[model samples]
Target: MLKKFAKQTLVAVSLAVSIPVFAASYTIGTGSQSGTYYPLGGILAKIWSENIDDFDMRAEVTAASVENTIKVATGKQLVGIAQGNVVLQANEGVKPFPRKMDVSVLFALYPNAVQFMVPADSDIHSISDLKGKRISLGAPGSGTRVSSVNILSTLGINESDVKPQSLNYTATTNALANGQIDAGVIVGSLGVGAITELALTRNIRILSFSEDDMQKIIAANPSYQPLEAPAETYKNVPAFTTPAVWNVLVVNKNMPQEQAYEMTKVAFDNMKKIRQVVGVTKFTTLENMNKLSGIALHPGAQQYLDEQMKK
Candidate 1:
């Protein structure tokens, strides 16, 4: 009986040793829970975890673009989602970033439309009217804040001229609904949940940028492009034009090229599944990959793009 028990113990040890373990684990830094970045990161994580052999991934909620860039640059996280303009600024050592960050883009994901929202009955009419008004320019270290600053500067409005409030999308919406803030800027894809929810309870006006204003903004910051919010995107709201920036997926430059290549492949292969989770399919395409300018591509990403071009 002792020999038989010993034999069974030896067999269990051997089986445990033979079982395969995950080769590596990675974390993806995403934006707030209410935004697109978090849900999109979850989808990508699912795809990578399932398709990449012996690999594991986790998506972490972060403060969005600027913070994500800093984390990925410092190697605190393996990958992150950030706006193209923020990535460019980080690479160039611009404000909010202490020094240049060595990061590379995996691919362009989607366009983040800058939505300036206020109560319908508010007297504020245009970007100029925002002067002297209490405005929530988005949370600190967020892409929305960076874009808002540019827009204000281009319009010749300084930060001191307006009462600036730092708040996230959800908080900004709540503040606006409660009349704590005169207006707020939200940077996200069309039909953002927070903005939609605010529209449901309160009539909101989406401020539009004039043609010259758009041109001035683009001239001051080439990262921004003109985009339009379609009619009926928000309840009872009409179409309006605004400045937009592309959101990109980035990884540390130190990440292995082969791993990045595999990740890119897996992302494209599971694009359909990703779309089922987030309705921003129109922006996630091979052709849109070219839209990712100003940011350098990871070697693995470049290799994948080259292969696609050859095909």
Candidate 2:
């Protein structure tokens, strides 16, 4: 009986040694729970956890783009989702960014269409109309707010000219629905939850940028690319052309090349799975990788892209 018990213990030990253990669980800092970044981060984390060999990634709710830049640069997060313009600002030590950040781009996600929305029946019809009207420009110091200010100023509407309300996407939408605010800015991917919810019962119109308006916005900041939101993107919303900033995935530049390469490859390989849930993620492809500017791609990411060239 003693020999048989010893034999079973030895077999159990061998089996345990043979099984692969998850090396580490990393955190990907994403935006608020109601925004696009959060869900996209969640989807990527789930895909990585399942597809990667002995690795797991979890998503953490964050204040979004601006905070994500600092988190990844400070080593507080392994990965993060941030707006492309914010990334450029962080790289260049622009306002809201104290100094140049040390980071690397992993992939370009999607565009955050800077959607200026107001009640459909409201007389507001142009960016200039926002003057003296209450506007919610995301949370204070957020990427969305940065875009709002940049665009407004480029279009000749200064912050002092408008009542700027610093609120999150959810609160901004709620405020608009409740008539507490005159206009709101939602800088997010198509079908952002807050806007989707508000559009369900409230008649909201997404203000679009005219051709000249877009040209000026982009000239001031090349990070702002123009995109059109399709009518089907949200209920009662029409297809409108607007200036957008690309959303991107990033990692600390210090991450080892092999790890970064592996992570980048894994994400692109499994991007189809991501697209299944979020159709907009279809932009997360090798073809769209050039969307980023002023930020260097990690060596590992470049290596992976090179490898794809061979394929």
Best by lDDT: 1
On residues 48-162, what C-alpha lDDT tens digit does candidate 1 reach at each position? 9999998888899888999899999999888999999999989889887888888889999899999999899989888999999999999998999998987898899999999
* Model 1 misplacement above 4 A: 1-20
Best candidate (score: TM-score): 1
Instruction: Estimate the Cα RMSD of every predicted model relative to the unseen true structure.
Output: 3.2, 4.0
Model 1 gets an lDDT of 0.89
lDDT of each: 0.89, 0.88
TM-score of candidate 2 to 2 decimals: 0.91
Give the residue spans of candidate 2 off by over 4 A: 1-22
lDDT of 2 by residue, 175-259 (tens): 9999999999989987888889989999999997899999998889988888978886789777888898899997888999998
Error of 2 at 97 (Å): 0.5
Q: Model 2 residue 153 lDDT? A: 92
